[model samples]
Target: MALVKVFSGSEILAQSLKVRIEAAGVNVIVKNNIQSSNMAGFGSLGQAVEVFIEDKDKEKAAQAIEDFKMGN
Candidate 1:
């Protein structure tokens, strides 16, 4: 299954979305550039973290994300 990005923001927000999406029965993977850079002993100037889900679950995940954004 192809992975599609559903959200990109702070690591905290990404993790929050991950939990919400997973609760909706969608799998999630988080990519944190800052954390990766820190592991490599390099400083990252970017603060963006990404949350990905399978393309097959895109519609459901999208609605979940939207609800989250709407504070629902």
Candidate 2:
């Protein structure tokens, strides 16, 4: 199995946060997407998204994400 980077989860902050972070430089292949969990118009959050990346670039990938969040 490949590495799974949790960009977002059951929350918005976590969802976009992850994307902005990785998008800094590393390749962001949105594996899963954040969407409505169930059939309803009440709850909405990071449904589920997956992105693939080189194992070696994991560190850089993580940093890019952090920087993106910190607005660096």
Q: For this target, which candidate reaches the highest lDDT against the unseen true structure?
A: 1
Q: List TM-scores for all candidates, in order.
A: 0.88, 0.41
Clashing pairs in 1: none
lDDT of 2 by residue, 1-72 (tens): 355563544444555655664566655545444343344445444446454565666777776666755767
Worst 10 residues of 2 by lDDT: 32-41
In angstroms, how far off is 7's CA in candidate 2?
0.7
Q: Please, what are the lDDT tens digits per residue for candidate 1 over residues 1-72? A: 898988888888888889999988888999899888989999887556998899989887787899889988
- In candidate 2, which residue pairs clash? 21-65, 31-50, 32-49, 32-50, 33-48, 33-49, 34-47
**How does model 2 score by TM-score?**
0.41
TM-score of 1: 0.88
What's the lDDT of the predicted structure labeled candidate 1? 0.86
